[model samples]
Target: MKASKVLITGVSGFIGEALVFRLLVDKKFIPVAAARRATKFQGLCPVVSLDLNAPEAFPAFDDVSVVIHAAARVHVMNETASDALSEFRKVNVDGTLHLAKKAAESGVKRFIFISSIKVNGESTPPGKPFLADDVPAPMDPYGVSKREAEDALKQLGSETGMEVVIVRPPLVYGPGVKANFLSMLRWLSRGVPLPLGAIHNQRSLVALENLVDFIVTCINHPDAANETFLVSDGYDLSTTQLLRQLAAALGKKCRLLPIPQRCIIIVATLLKQKAVAQRICGSLQVDINKAHELLGWVPPVSIELAMRRTVDHYQDKQTK
Candidate 1:
């Protein structure tokens, strides 16, 4: 079946950009990209400026058959709890509800929400990854807000009969990615000795391309309706392993020192950097078996390939 018009919020974001490109190239979905400002999108798509906080900022959805809600205030340290909660509610929850309501009124079919695995908490216990059915225990305000958004979307689904597909993804990185992960790559490329070599913490991460593939698949997948799915590259990595892999991708030797976890934690606490330490030393992993079984979806890109692509993108940007 041919897909009707699709609307995507946060088109200027990392995942949103990649998803928009994929939709334009592969699925050929009629793309409508929305952002707060005018910017250059890689490919041609009907771009619209919409401030999700305002009720009238949402565009007319009468022609939109599917809505991919990807816009969110997604910074870990830059935002206060109150600010983050309000922003998340405005964009992720309220904006989502607004779109869903319009879609239902306009006879739109699906609403795909890009949620975070942080909703399951900062870390999973030993020998167990977060399952799809686990009760949400978000550690920070961002996660809490995302959890609220998910609930709101589900409630909207129940109320309006619009199909809601919630995709909870972990750290998504690749070309054009930002945040601490990219910072680590830059540090590693400079041959800096990271003290996280001894910290054994497993974290799940998804590649941008892989995540975009899943989002595109979910757009029309019948099993996605009213279901929440955790997505990953299906590979878990420790801090040391991740650093080593990153170093390898950059063709640089891993200059890592085996630092004591206690010492690191103590220093971080004394320096009022507990959040940074938690991110580097936490064990957050997700089990994506449900996605595989339900949607018959699997990551087409390998971890090594994903990291390599990221390194290449960074290098090219540097040269430019």
Candidate 2:
């Protein structure tokens, strides 16, 4: 029997690259890399350049059994676009639907969309984790575009016979992680004292390895069809706990001042960084029980192991 062919969009991206590696390691699928720009895969797989910004540049889905749509116009902190929402919809919504239609027409069996937890909302109230079935309440243009893409995907799947599986993941960490997670690692390694010791709000994070594992499961699992799943590490941590863990992983002493969350927010507001403050101080927990019950999926990597890998990668990069 031949291995199934899985085409992964955004193959040059962090999550897409990781997912392709996992599939290759498992030796269960023939991974096809697709991205907007050229990426050297060491001739490991066939590479196709498919820019989501180009509405008509559709990659040929010949012999593709699964299409994992991981490419998207991710959220921008300081957006300079004239119309941020329109720009986001152009790539995330319109581009996604166009690709899905082509996949469905080409007999692609399953289309696994990598959505973001922002579709559910930015933050969750303490003790009230966001469920997969919750009413979507996107708070920003990026999140709204994701929600629109998801709805459009489901509709397309229904019209055609292709199965659609949506996986919404929170802040993903591990080796090669950037943005806020990397910043935390740097801060801890440099022994910069943080004012997050008093924050008790819970946030859910998924390891990059763990998220790839889940996506692999959705590739062919019958229960994953037409389902929207929220995934995490099954571990919720406070800001203080996360800082402490990163510090330990980097072999540095955690230096966190017990500053009031309110005061930090006030300072951030004054500095025109209230959004950053909310991310650091607010709670965004997701309940992965649906994934557990339906697909019997569990994050294989523990938080500790994930953090260690992240720190090691950061250190290796710095040394080079």
Candidate 3:
């Protein structure tokens, strides 16, 4: 098959960087890197300086067959912005709409958006999981923005004949992962005795490799047109199980105390860390059956291997 030119936003981000490398290695797609500091992929492919905040600032999208929209105003742990919703909408909503319009005008075919599971709500019941067709109930500013962006993109696609594919993924982790996932790794590596052994909440996570593979599948799959898909590792793990697996990957002994879930939540609420507690103890699982039935897609990487690679990278960086 002939290679296609794919313009990828957020080329410097963890997923974007991995996607670019994957495309390069597969030799099936030509990646046109776009980011604020686009020089990172300068020599690898064509580079374009893109600022999501500046919606009017866009580069020529001529000849780009597909666009993987990975950039966004990501969730902040301690947001200092005066209007967090407005700040997020400025980039994730307005910026995304503008880019999609430009791409449509330029004759781009498909737009694959990287959305968040937060759009489906913060948590789910023990056995129930989020589905792609569920009514959206975003909980935070960042998630609201993504939901708005998804709506706008679908509307734009309907009006302009461009196909839009929205993929909502749960916590994604792999090599170069940051934020809470990395923090968990750090805590476990230090052998911190966490009082999370008794919690039995299930959470779904996607490996960076699995997500990148799914995005590539969406780029040209005819069945993916104008569809919303929920993606994950197809495996749900409890907090205790996750810690144990991570500790094993890091070559450390897992230290956990059988603290009551209610007590943990109460303490976190008192400390104004209730949100953090919810993430650790809450259930957030996604059903990926739609992706499987429609695109015949399955995660090519195992969680165990993904964690091993992540641990290897983290250990290497620590040594350096």
Residue 96 deviation, candidate 2, in Å?
Answer: 0.4
Q: Candidate 3 — worst ten consecutive residues by lDDT sum? A: 37-46
The stretch of ten residues in a row with the least summed lDDT in candidate 2 is 51-60
Order candidates by TM-score, high to low.
Answer: 3, 2, 1
How displaced is residue 124 in candidate 3, in Å?
0.5
For each candidate, what is the lDDT?
0.85, 0.92, 0.92
Give the clashing residue pairs of candidate 3, or none. none
Best by lDDT: 3
Per-residue lDDT tens digits for candidate 3, residues 1-320, read 66889999988788888889989898898999999874667898888888877766788896899999999889989999999999999889999999999999999999999999989999999889999999999999999999999999999999999999999998899988999889889999999999998999999999999999999999999999999999998899999999999999999999999999999999999999999999899999899999999999999999999989999999999999
lDDT of 2 by residue, 110-196 (tens): 999999999999998999999999999999999999999999999999999899999999999989998878888888989998888
List residue ranges in candidate 1 displaced over 4 A: 1-3, 80-84
lDDT of 3: 0.92
TM per model? Answer: 0.95, 0.98, 0.98
